[model samples]
Target: MTRTARSRALGSRPARSRTARQHAVGLAALLLLVAAAPASASATPSPASSPARHLEGTLPSGAAYMIDTPDHWNGTVLLFSHGYRPEGSPNPAVNAPDEPTKQLLLKEGYALVGSSYATTGWSVEQAVPDQLAALDAFTKEVGAARRTLAWGQSLGGLITTTIAERYPGRIDGSLSMCGLVHGGVANWNSTLDATFALRTLLAPGAGDADVRLTGFKDAADAAASAKRLGETLGTAQNSADGRARIALAAALHAIPGWNDPRTPRPAPDDYPAQQANQYTAVRGLVAQPGFAWRAEAERRAGGNMSWNTGVDYSAMLARSSQYKEVKALYKSAGLSLRDDLRALARAPRVSAEPRAVRYMADHAAPSGRLDKPQLTIHTTGDALVPVRTESAYRQAVAEAGRSPLLRQAYTENAGHCTFSPGEQLAAVHTIDHRLTSGSWGDTSPSALNSRAQQADPTTEARYTTFRPGPYPRPFRGQGLFG
Candidate 1:
């Protein structure tokens, strides 16, 4: 008999202190590099700049928010949306990414404000509204700015884009970093492709076919499921065929072999080191945070919102960034790549409940009908939220006839939300320039790098001109992108 995927019963959120930012939302999922740290110790405020006026409060919806306005206001206010908060992490109602970045922006005369969404786990439903409410509150507190710009990291990046699409008149322009820009349905569904590959090729015993993929009864249920997958991944690492299969699974999600932001990227041909890194990288991702993300999304969307009914595994491998790696590894292990994909083809497929897909599309997905100008940036080697998100969003935007409104850039770095203070400031300045000049200036990698180094010499800014491949599993199904 097949074990059930998830219990229909809803789960309770883990109690957490309102403190440090949760890694799930941040998606720098692992490896925090001190070298990437910005806000240099030697830097001092400009003589013309003064400390910001700080204000904090709770919205009527119960979301806490904070605002900071410099003494010399620039007639601009940046509305920040934070990443998704895991169910049971220490979440602080924060607006800015770091104290230094905040100070640098304020010192440069820009005001900033952000809200801790009404509730934590998978806050997309309330995140945009909470942010809009915070914007209203900010306007009431200090009068309306000349213009408002929206910006966010990770899930907040999705929220930032949603605001532009749904309520553009409220803001002039926006920026999204390391965002799940493809939409919620695509997120879950594509991830299902990756996890499905893992289970089919590497599951110990009966495999994760028995594991709960969604509608988790609670965080523990999701976590326990994640644990099983992690253990499977661990055991698979010790064998040649297992490593090859791991490469295939990682490729499905565009999981990079390079894991840390602080460390230099692995040489392109170093397949062994890369595969080993992928093993470690994917292990952390399959943990509680990853499954819990799906669980919370399911809880919000009303059911299993992801499926893999007709995804072409062969085509998916063809489009993967790590396609060559998978092939090379398979040959090294004397495994037939064709055989495994055929097995995946024969494996039982998962289907989504119609209601969940509809709910997720309306609230959590990007329609690509961009109303305001958008500047998106991503780290090239981002493990959790791959750079392909930008690629897919660009396709969606081009299809929507809104390509002119979006400008995408990439960092020659790894990890999620790992931008330095200078790089972060550079994005703000770039978007601000567009909003002001009514034209996107030279946004080339070299130009951005120059701008970042000029802003914060202490931080590194390695921008690159890159074109990401096709999104492996887009939600071309009805009720979304239709």
Candidate 2:
């Protein structure tokens, strides 16, 4: 999720459940592979007919790992990577996308494993190593499997791809769901555009020259920043002009106009409704790591990495899916859109430190140089890690001449990581098919939808054909400017 970083990505539960589940997946990884996660210690048990052995331990890296193996051994394994967990988050363990999927996987005899990274949010640098350590632990503790298949959600999704690209021999295939496939550098840089616009246009302390964006002093400082931005959103939502400006900020990052999975999608041409949804996306940023994760990445990278030194707001907006929404709202509010763009042009620009910029590319960016098959799935309306990120990855893969190895699918759902038990199983089966056949079978919506229905007839399957828009900012290929 780097934060669709998924509210469950395609489906989220209540706020409490979502956070708990997200953290749960991050906590488990070492040893023999499996696809069944039991969630927290107190979570309800899965009803697998085959008895399963559960194991938990801490790796040398201080990361926690968990595993569940069915009594009947399946030669193949499912190594799961989890989403982002804020530092100090409680309970690190494996959490399947949903409960039914866990039971189903175990019933079919797939072993599941995952690891909590060495650190929380933006811990991509440590994710792969931690997982591998967990794999070694699993091998020592449980024994080796004939084959391994990797799958992940949110930030873990990116880790899964990196595994496919950098260490393809370790696994046969990859499944990334609700992933920030564009990579962390691009993720933060584009987010900065929206944050910068919100700060300059609507922050209560807009005129204050000393407010900090990065280089957080501590968790308290990050919390304060989140609180301030949240207040800005709350106050801004009260006025038409304020809401219009909010659209400008959210659109800059291509935040989807559909905010809640619980609600039906807004009409395609309903500018006002879409703008309102964009407000939810912009506001949702405040609920993330309170910008502390940015600090985490900054520290690891050696300095500040995200910036807006030479961005052209007009050009940026023109590329956004919400361009018409912003124009319509601004015009309706009697605000001059060009003037606002000019104002952004004049605002103090943040510049990336060279060391950090280099770190961003080497550590955070994905080379897209794949040596194995990878399938990426996303919700079309995920605002957190917008669907456009898939577009960015598609470009990267094409550029790397590995486009044929990558297959991207989508669910017509609204929230991040919102797939059902059926949908998740369908994806797993799809990857398994490729591994067994040495080719990606038809990945079209019709084929996938039918597969999902067969996987879980009880759950609604909404897979569909889609092409996400271009990512607003890409740091991998672009040099300093991105």
Candidate 3:
């Protein structure tokens, strides 16, 4: 079925609950004030029909973990790493994407495990060790598995990859779904580029002197800045020139033209519609208040972790897949591309503090040294975590001389982490097949789609053959963020 029809069937998404925000605040306060002490595992009896052993406990670092072992004992454990949660957000009891997927894996005889992490909000450094502690705790309490797979979503994707790279002997394979594998430096700098362009082209007289780009002291300040920028973009979208400018900014980062999952992908030449969709993504999702993970990242790293110094917009434009659309929009709007490029060149650029850069490099950026088979999946129209991340990651893997060990898949759908149960299962099965057979199987789109259909008829159709455009603002080398 078409995306529009599916969207109509699903209807509009609900707003975030106030209770959730409140819980986050409470959790954040508790974590900051209290010191964590080592704790032992607590075992719970499983259902009679399931016959699985469930264990829960806290680590010395104060992170909580959950483990499920089926009675059949498949000798394989799947370590699940969850996506980023804002500081103060309530910790999850289990990190699986969906309960159905969890149950299916358990029934299939795979053990499930995940940790809450030591502290929240851009805590990859803490997570790496904390997750290791969880694994060690699992081994100590439940005995070692014959094989283990590192599986994570979003930021957890990065963690999963890091585990495989840093401790290859501990993991047999890895799967990263909708992950920011491109690293913190490139991802957040790309975000800064979009926000900077918005402020410069649309709200030139804000008078805060680029404070919107870097002066976030807290969530409230970040929210206020995001609100102002969002309102400006909304007003600018009314004019042809304004829309063209938005396209240029989005193209700079290879932002997708699909934002609303309820809508279908725009036709290639539909610049106005495309820009409109991108504007909704930037303003509503990327620039939203709760979406301000950068502030926390900066605070943790001791200063700004992103920089756009020495960037050449012309060169970036030349590399972007959206260049054709951008050129078309500019020409139709009677605007000069040269003039926009000049404006970007003349704008004040942001730079990162050295210590902050080092922190991110040590804690977040992936070395791309793959020691085992790894698979990645992304939606073609993802806005929050952009499909360009997949492209950036592919480049990193290639540069590390591990291209043979990496495989990527794509879906035609929009939104972040929007995979269906069937799609998720198909990915897991693909990795499992490789591990079990000691050779990669038929991972073609048609084959995966067929597998998904068999598992769940309601699964969204797959677009595994889709190749994402190049990441326009990729980090070139270690010098920038290392």
Candidate 4:
């Protein structure tokens, strides 16, 4: 996502045939929306329970999407925009919300809508407008009032925040989860950190050695260093350094040789899991001379470089003033920052949907409001989004005197949506409270906590069983990235 011009984000799913009961539940929800509408309703959008309607269309860019509408939409609408996919693909409208979210929204009479935002090739600027357009189309067709709620996950989160800032009164509430708020700053910083790590792996005992790639004139020297780096990777992976090992594997996977240049990598292939295991396996054999077998294998196979990694890294590194001072970090990591920087500048600019960009551009502060209440949630330990981004944004908003309109929730020991039932229910309740009352509730334990503490194990098990599966369609070839 960082490498891609338009930043998108997140994971995958499993398939189970829909059940009769499920269909019944959906139908029931739809009927309620239609029946609940006010007879005298005029242009003002009001909440109603209607069966969700799916709409599809082509955007100006020729990008297409399928959007799902949860029926009986209370004019209070929720729109989710997905983050960037390295493949530059768009997401289906219903990308990230869980089953619980759908049920809760439907039962609450909230209309939930999502779309793939036309072409994935467009950046957030284009995608955000497309979403707005989609909403316009939906309003005309459904006759729902214009009062709305906008939200997105990762890249979608980025889009939502920008919209919230830009659109002001147009949006009632905004939620962005694990989005890249700092743009070039965050991307460049992370890349420098990665390069630094790589350098450390290469020069184990020589930790004091500078990571100057210029010193190495040819493939032989670079390959030798790469071999050393591989051994370090092996050691780290095998030494019970869980996070470090995961980080290394993730960085490697991000590079060209490890991943498929085409097509979004699905979640189920467990690419990260596989990469970790592969590193572990190779690490076990590093004591054997010529232990950098994998790195050597890659070189022998022509080491086809990925276009995104180096190019994006260079673009960010150049744009970021901080990266300039941190150049030594790369030098210590044994990488040629100068060469990569030049090469990336000359590379083509990646394209992305304009909707997200427009949303961000519109909502930027000094020009936006600070009166509406907003709640942001992000897993503290998220490797992908890097929790720092969330914290930084909150700080920025607070510093801007918008603290009254902003609040943040941190999920513990969770991945993207991998929260415990207590966490999920607590979040749902919080959102409901904010939407219904326009106020973040006073500090108090939630119903979910009480239930978790005293409820019967059988009931608890049943509730847990209903939890949404990880990445709804992981390998089904149906994601924004795919």
Give me the candidate number with maximum lDDT. 1
Q: What does candidate 3 score on TM?
A: 0.85
| Cα TM-score of candidate 4 | 0.53
Alpha-carbon runs more than 4 Å astray in model 1: 1-51, 204-209, 476-482
How big is the positional error of residue 57 in model 3, measured in Å on the Cα after superposition? 2.1
Residue-level lDDT tens digits of model 3 in 404-457: 889899887888888888898888888888889987788889888887877677
Lowest-lDDT window of 10 residues in candidate 3?
Answer: 1-10
lDDT of 2 by residue, 145-230 (tens): 76788899999898888888888888888899999788877887877788788888886346323346766676667667877778
Q: For candidate 1, give the lDDT.
A: 0.82
- For each candidate in turn, the TM-score is 0.87, 0.86, 0.85, 0.53
Taking every candidate in turn, the Cα RMSD to the unseen true structure, in Å, is 15.2, 12.5, 13.6, 16.1
For model 2, give the 10-residue run with minimal summed lDDT. 1-10
- What CA RMSD would candidate 4 show? 16.1
- Superior by lDDT: candidate 2 or candidate 3: 2
Cα lDDT tens digits, model 4, 1-482, are 00111222455645545796698789999989977976564634344644566556655554454444555555566666766543323345563366654655555565655666654431555676777765665565555554566776766776777677766666777766656553322332333344344443434334313332212333455445545655556555443333233334233212211122122333433344434433432333332211222222223223311112233444434433223223433344455656544433453322212332232233321222445666666554344445555545655676677877776666433244344444433444555567778677652333334433342222221122111111111111111110
Q: Looking at model 1, how many pairs of residues clash? A: 3
The TM-score of candidate 2 is 0.86
Better of 1 and 2 by lDDT: 1
Q: After superposition, how far is residue 420 of candidate 4 from its true place, in Å?
A: 6.0
184: Cα error in model 3, Å = 0.9
In candidate 3, which residue ranges exceed 4 Å CA deviation? 1-50, 205-210, 289-291, 474-477
**Rank ordering of all candidates by lDDT, starting from the highest:** 1, 2, 3, 4
* Model 4 CA deviation exceeding 4 Å by range: 1-52, 88-91, 182-184, 200-232, 235-371, 420-429, 443-482
